[model samples]
Target: MDRSKQLYEQDATDWQRGMYEDIKTTFRAPIVNWYFRSLTANEPAFTRYLWGQLKPLFQTRAFGRYAVSYRDTVLSAIEDGPADLPRYRRADTALRPAEWRELRGQLATFDVVAPRLALTFAVCDRAMHGDLPDANPEGAPSTAPLPPWLDRDRGQSVTMLEAGDVPGDLSETVDEIRAFHGLEEGLPSIYRCLAQWPGYLEPAWTDLEPILESEAFERGCRDADAVVDGHLEELPYTPRLSPNDLAEQGFDDETIDDIQHYVRAFNRGAVSKVLQTIVTYAATLDAGGERSL
Candidate 1:
């Protein structure tokens, strides 16, 4: 299977599409993330099993609080920093009122998904490193229902521009993003989507680039990692998708290695930083009130 290939929602089988719906519903967001789509593409069975293994992590009230805290911590980090994030408005950009609203809502969606991805990667990273959580901790977090207010349909469907689809003038912007995220090629879905609105993406990146490079952003990443770790410590139950666990479940060594490779790619430095950056961008738009948009 091509690691880069993804079984997007439209191309998925009926059953696979149903699983995607389950994921969206469980995550309380409208879109399936790229990580899961990639996983499903490469190995649907393993992806399904992995979802079952990790679903418990997201279902608990503790995880809900963790998600909220993760967003707050990222925002607080930005707020506490010396440079203020430029709060761009509809009037400031060339987008029509509807387009501006769509941009804000789309970013708001990313805000909701960011922390969830953080927790996903953190759990996978720890488990793969042979530091599995205790199945039965002495004082586990509550297994109560997730909070009702947690991102219930807050974002619109996510769409992104293909590499060829990106405008020529925005080449500098694309290159800067690729360089910042250390990508040899290709932009992340978030940036690709933002690229559809050059009016916003260009200026926003101009203001955001320097701040993302600052020591302050680095500190925020560290602080956000700590917040994720703190919540992982409070997990009510362990996730059973470690390498050993996968082997026991009859996955081949090659399959295990492939899983590890993908997990490490997303769980490493760049994904988390991008996740936090998305949150910071979304929070800025959110401060002005989504209703007014």
Candidate 2:
């Protein structure tokens, strides 16, 4: 346990140092500040609005990357979990193994999204500086390969939506589905309150015409289809289940509601932690009298 504590402290110190360096370098740019302002907009309401606009851009691949990154950091800390000894010693020693495991799982989930929150902050900083990346040109060739980090199908989904090939209502439905899958945080309450929203499978075959009409959109569809097909074709032949099917599999209404509430609360806490970390690191850089941009 003492060894674990030492390792935890060591890692925490390293993380703090890396954060300081990041603030002094990449985060010091005027673009980052601009981006922050755009996303956060000084008002809580605006923050929600910005999230509504951006949430659809998050897809399964992106979510998977977030989850994996978060899981790795969290699991490492768990091996060092008992390292909170100084504080533990000062408090009750009533910790149980199950509780510890549960707490660790929560931390892992939190870690998964922390870097994404950091990236969002960076994007906001850039927007504030009027340095937003140019919107991809209309009718541009869609054949350009995606970044290795991106989920291929998810990227294709974004390409289709942005091209306006999908009906606006259908696109919004897709966004809602992504949000339900734990992709990102801050979905508007209005979206949540709506009932009987169109499911992805319900989209009419006729409605696909617009998507197929644009060459760029068609390319995206092909790419996304390839990804979906590959997943379907892969080992141990399990059938794909729809969202409704998953929802129906035995949880009581109260339990489902509780789960939703918890997910929202977790997202709020994670966002708060990320913001606090960024601000603290930025302050350290400022104290050193470093000019960022």
Candidate 3:
């Protein structure tokens, strides 16, 4: 399989695709997370090896409950940071009920999934890098079930747009996103996924572009990581996927470290930023501001 085409979910195996959908259904997300996409770029062998062992952990009924709770703690990490971002509502459009529903679903999906995935990537990054997380944090976060309002819409799945599928018209926007990341690591999945809803993209970029270039926003990411990291500290992370395990599985130091690069980049660079943006977007919508666009 070509490395370029591998970024899309459509090219994966049936079982691999099923696993991807299972994750989406569990998290109520409309898209394949970049973590899995990056992992499966090579015929799903490494991904299958890693996730097969980890699936049982997610299958535990308690895991979903814990994930929802953990998400809240992650959001709290930087919920109050300065966006310094002007709201860019759709200027020429009024959302129909259906559009509103989809928009709401999209926002809600990220609200939960972003943070949960953030913690997951964090654990995997540390594990692969030989940084053992504490079995329990100094103050572990609660694992309470989500409240009725928070748990309401589980969100319908949508067609995920790949990098190559981005419209020619949006090339400039994609360029801006690349510039925002400042590391040439590849555009964030949030941008590509949200581009499916251009109306939302208008506002999302409006808010994110400025903040992504600023000093305070970086600090906010660190702030959020502190909170999420504190909670994740308590994860009883398995050593099966650690550096030692990868080494035993025939991966050399460089190979193991390469995996860590993807994990760590997605964990620190994309996941938390996407979470904060989604949280802020949800807050704006819920406030019932000017309705049009």
TM-scores for every candidate against the unseen true structure: 0.93, 0.26, 0.71
- Identify the runs in model 3 with alpha carbons over 4 angstroms from their true place: 1-14, 53-93, 137-153, 160-175, 183-186, 207-219, 250-257, 268-272, 287-293
lDDT of each: 0.80, 0.29, 0.58
Q: Could you tell me which 10 consecutive residues in candidate 2 have the lowest summed lDDT?
A: 151-160
Clashes found in each candidate (C-alpha, N, C closer than 3 A): 0, 19, 1
Per-residue CA lDDT of candidate 1, range 1-293, in tens? 46578999989887798899898988777889989998899899998988887877787777777777777666667778899978877878879998988898888778778888999998887787677556543333347767676678788888788988999999999999989989887778788888889998898889988888887788788888898888877777787877888889899989888788778878885777888888777865662212110
Considering lDDT, which of the candidate structures 2 and 3 is the better prediction for this target? 3
The residue-level lDDT of candidate 3 at 160 comes to: 51
**Candidate 2 on 84-143: residue-level lDDT in tens?**
111121013233554433332322222222334444443333333333344332221122
Native-referenced Cα lDDT, model 3: 0.58
TM-score of 3: 0.71
Identify the candidate with maximal lDDT: 1
Query: What C-alpha lDDT does candidate 2 achieve relative to the native structure?
Result: 0.29
> Ten consecutive residues with minimal summed lDDT in candidate 3?
284-293
